[model samples]
Target chain A: MMAVARAKSRKADEANNPSSQVLRFGADKPLILEAGVKLAPFQIAYETYGELNADKSNAVLICHALTGDQYVASTNPVTGKPGWWEVLIGPGKIIDTNRFFVISPNVIGSCLGSTGPASTNPATGKPYGLDLPIITIRDMVRAQAMLVDHFGIDQLFCVIGGSMGGMQVLEWTSTYPDRVFSALPMATGTRHSAQNIAFYEAGRQAVMADPNWRGGKYIEAGVRPEKGLAVARMIAHITYLSEVALHRKFGRNLQDRQKLTFSFDADFQIESYLRHQGMTFVDRFDANSYLYLSRAMDYFDMAADHDGQLAAAFKNTKTRFCVVSFTSDWHFPTEESRALVHALNASGAPVSFVEIETDRGHDAFLLDEPELFSAIGGFVASAARAKGLA
Target chain B: MSVNSNPRIDLQVVADLIPDNAKVLDVGCSDGELLELLRNQKNIDGRGVEISQRGVNECVARGLSVIQGDADTDLVYYPDNSFDYALLSQTLQATRNPRAVLEHLLRIGEHAIVSFPNFGHWSVRTSLFFNGRMPVTKDLPYSWYDTPNIHFCTIRDFVVLCDEVGAKVEKAVAINANGQKMGFSMPWWFWNFFGQQAVFLLRR
Candidate 1:
């Protein structure tokens, strides 16, 4: 369903003149990654709505998910779609951008304006590809912190995200406890589960198995791995939704035909819909960046870093936390959120939790779920009051 | 008197028991009226555990820290002495094991505040005595088969359970049918028969 916009030059142009502001850090201020590598002379592309108050306490950092970019509440220049979280963020919406200064940064390892596998490497004058040092969730948060520092925001009013973005939120609260006033990590977990790693492995294999992949050097080859990346996107898309959501959207109904044409073509409506999702995703997302971001999610285990105690990761943290999950989200289920709440309780952190009842599954965080909106709105308002914000 | 004044009376009593700047956990805090009251009046840091998703949502929308959790199964996740007070208002009887849940409350907080409808009130006793069936009054409005109050207890019974569980009653208040407090010097049986509901403050 998407126009073919997979050319290397088009993506490079997006990197050069991103739709939003870009913050650059020279070799003097290198980002020390968790992988024991230093990434210098990098830049972070971000979008800002609303104004930072005099005290700078009104800033809210919005971290995007695995494939999400910095276009949080504006139009994306590449795909021409509305910002991913426009449903919950705007002038008078749930997050209330009119009052709170909202900042959304394209992560360091994503295919967006950020320096990812698709960005030109300073050393070789080519796309970093696999040469880009592996980035972790901690690494992504560290890079965003530099952007926050650029604005002179000592502490963010709130840090919010779902799925992979949620992982970054947790990392911010854990690593830089004093820098965040409040945190909302929804539809996520402390560590990637075995099942999550298995699903991502299947998607990564799909990308690598295609002949056009060229061993992660497809951009230099002048032929993108369209089929491989499409298959990978399709595999990951199924995990984002629940079986009930799939059934409700597309049951056993045929794809615009009187009877089944069972010849390996798109016979079922679900098949056609999945194909559209995959095809649309490859146009905007880079294939090798997908592999790197998913691997970063796989390596995220906060508890392991803190001597096998998740509570220890948040020791003596004064930041208020509000954890949210969906009932039908088996990908990152309510049980995972409960585990996070339990850790926060053990650490004596001010925390609240809610498990929203919805059939929409993990993607419910991104959809028009009123209950999620109310929960986030209420929590944000209360936190704002606590911060003495008008 | 209007009907709403009475419930407010006991809730006010629960709010009065807490001090300023205290960390409070309101177990079974349906919609968080009591916690909200404490937060506004006493300036206490309040948290809540509600059993229903709807109740939890409503509580959160009011800016109260609430989680959807069953009192029977979820209290074990809390650390010891985490709060200044833990409250179980009108929700103790609905638990599967009221004794164990009470023990958990005491363990999780420095003090526990409990409130429940007394089954030995004259109206409840008279209904069962004359009708020869489970009582259904204004306070206890459900039949035995459909009632969520499975582990029902009277004022005297709760006091005995508190003693059995090694908890000392720091303070106790009994509210009569008209939402008036009974005499403080009265014996347990007098409050058990005359009082409609009771609120107790206990500590280990």
Candidate 2:
């Protein structure tokens, strides 16, 4: 019964009640997307921890990655699991909720209580599906800026994130330089590379190729593209991991039987693990949302918007930046982060660049990496000192 | 401890040369001790380029602006005369091309301060003459096979390179084994024979 209910309301229900605090922007304050579409009656769902100081200068914005919601350091109502970034954000953790007011919002165009393709279009009184105007990283950040403005926070103490979230962080700095005192953009680049675009294209193709996708109207048809979305998730999941990590975790290990089945069954533990990953993802994520979000990432090119010089994007910016990359993260390799650091340097911005020694690939930022913790912890403490946060 | 024998004193000499509030870049800034010192004491805007990941991490932990980059390759990215002072301490010998690195330092900063161990010191010459093997001293700790100091030079050789690079020496100080600077009146041959290390302030 629970699975049936979850499957039925996979799209609209979450757009209404996604398990946390939500902010509703009426038609009077429509979000003007970069594509020149004004989205009215939009809502931004978010979660906050710690208390805002009397001066309101201690607020930190934590941007979520693709498919990550606002449940930064708590339980997820849909997944029944801990928050994605709970490892680094707790009372005494690296982010240290006790010290700073951390606000994590579900970015616009994502399906977790934020206005996305799954939400009702209001124009037709039905799910927007593919009708929703395509959202860019800048659009997502602009919505977040409105959310921050609602709190009367003139300047965020820091803005931090990894992967897609990291892209948002860069956008935040570029779009509103004075509003961000410092930024930590980890495991991401200033622009998505061709390889990354190819991977995302493959995922999008898998979802569209499914018969149940119904021309992206699956939610209205009462049938979800579970099989296609699962395949997409499986393909994307592989990119998030490295060959070393894969070898270390499931080195040709069989799943229950001693020998191969010689059939189309999940013979290897890796295959079984990927299938489980795919199935669980389909339960909480929207297929159209995935297509939209991946498309948004592919369109991210900060340099192109700034006269083709990456340094021009940060000309005379005062925000302090710390760019980090993992040694084994092939998805967003160390060279990408180096490019960002070089741009920041050329622009005469105060920046610190560190490439951590890790075998955990792009997901290392979300794992128990002591070096990463120390680097972030130390950086935050120093920035806090500089910001005069007691 | 004498200025030439103590690494800390070597950094102090380099630190003493720069004026307060100057924009400085420390190439090969290992762990950022000099940059931190300059930031705190001189109140200068400081940046660093360290080749080692471990060193870069340590610098970031201290809240110093640093990047994981080689002095040889990464220095070209900076625009000319971007910094008031460029410092190279105890690291010039390790660079693949010392002449090019020195030229870059001069080009990137209006003034460059460099300090290096003098290979023409009496002890290094005697060690090679008697033992006929590479010299191992308190300053140069590594054996010849494992040494990172690839290009060793004397005080006179450095002066000649400065001339070749078209850098005018504003100030030059040669320190002996006793941690004291040799007399300024002494000739280049005398300082080359007795001086353990040398520090020079250069400008184009």
Candidate 3:
């Protein structure tokens, strides 16, 4: 759909211009892994909008979710649609590209423009595949720190994201407390709940069950494993929507049929929607990349990192926090977000929390929810004033 | 930090009770003027919770960290001793559960500063005694049907509640219609009738 946008970039030289392209880093500054390994010559695909002011404090890092790439306010190259959060981070929008510099980078494990399992291995002269070091949220953040340093920015005006993106935001705040002026983590939890992990495992299993997967070496085997990946996507998509949203959108209505055919084909509108979502997702996302990112989320445990004391993770943190949760988001419910707020409070870190009443569920952060927009707008504006951007 | 030279007398009294540089939470902090005052002037660490989104927006606009939440429900989320002081100004009477919120404030902070409109004031009494209608005054301006104040109480009633909840009243001040502090030595009945508002410093 957005083929035109991608086609133009190939003809244009991608030397060192800071518009939109893949920039390889971490060679001289290799990322030391939590697994006691080193990932060198790695690359990060990122896109930047607005202008970094002279003081360089106007930079706002926008982290994407598990499947999202670095298309914050623009059209996604894969789907040709406006970026997932254009409602929140665009010109004159809440994040306000007109006022602040925005940077969105594809996470390390994802398949977009970033180095992932699909990237060629410099050592072996083959696809890295499963050889790509398992990345944690912190690893993604450390890479972002490198990107921010590339711009000569010492501190960010704000680090904002939702879902897994929110997890990265938290990691950024805890890891580089002095660098972030304000943080907004929306519809996310500090750690993946057992139930959430169970769901992710289900998706991972669906990917693994495919004979075409070839045990994570599908890229080198020249196989797509579309079936298992589609099943995974279908299962994962259900968690992102609330029962209310599902009922409102579909409500058992047949998919372009007046009556059920009584076959294995989709009879309900929700079923057809999920199938469509699955098919479209397989066209863009990578199967092994999905496995690696999902596992990364399951492995995330901020409290466990701080010796089981969540407050210790935020000891002496100066970054102001704004945590948001939606009412019907059972996946990462309001209670989960409150835990982060409670930890921040115990550490005496300044934090604000809003449990927005919405039936939109986990995906509410991606949608055009007015409360989220206003809250983020007010928060960024305030942080900007405090950062001397006023 | 140029402190506001003139603050609302009730808020000024509330501000005086907070120690400099102490962490504080202001429940139902409408637009966060008191939080702004304490944060800028005394260098106190303060956050706030306001039920209305509009109030939260305004507070955030002024660079005050305020969350949109209800004190009655959200107070229980904070850990014990999270703040040095918990300030509730002109909000106690309007709470859905005054006792529970008060208990949380006292438990969550080393001390609490609670200020509310005195329903037993002489004007409200005379209006009820003579006019025989739900008394409306500058303090309790809302009529019975539309007021957010669900659990209205007098100064004496709040003092009774403190004892019931095992919280000691460290200091209590009553302000009149003109915002002048009344003598503490006065009898409860006299203060209840004459005072327009009451401020209390409580500790467990």
- Across B1-204, the per-residue lDDT of candidate 1 in tens digits comes to 111125546898888888899999999999888988899999999989999989988888888888888999999989999999999998988999999999999999999999988878887777778889887656456777998889888899999999999999999999987888888999988999888889999999
- Model 2's C-alpha root-mean-square deviation from the true structure amounts to 1.8
lDDT of 3 by residue, A27-134 (tens): 687877787788888878899999999889899999989888888888875567887887777788777888899988888877776667877778997777888888
Q: Provide chain B's TM-score, model 1.
A: 0.95
- Model 2: DockQ score: 0.80
DockQ in order? 0.72, 0.80, 0.39
Model 3: CA > 4 A from native: A1-19, B1-23, B30-33, B36-44, B51-58, B68-84, B93-111, B122-153, B160-171, B177-185, B202-204
Q: Please compute and give the TM-score of the first chain of candidate 3 against the native first chain.
A: 0.94
Q: Which ten residues in a row have the lowest lDDT in candidate 2 chain A?
A: A3-12
Q: What CAPRI-style quality would you assign to candidate 1?
A: medium
Better model by DockQ, 1 or 3? 1
Prediction-by-prediction clash tally: 0, 2, 1
Residue-wise C-alpha lDDT for candidate 2, range A130-156, written one tens digit per residue: 999999999999999999999999999
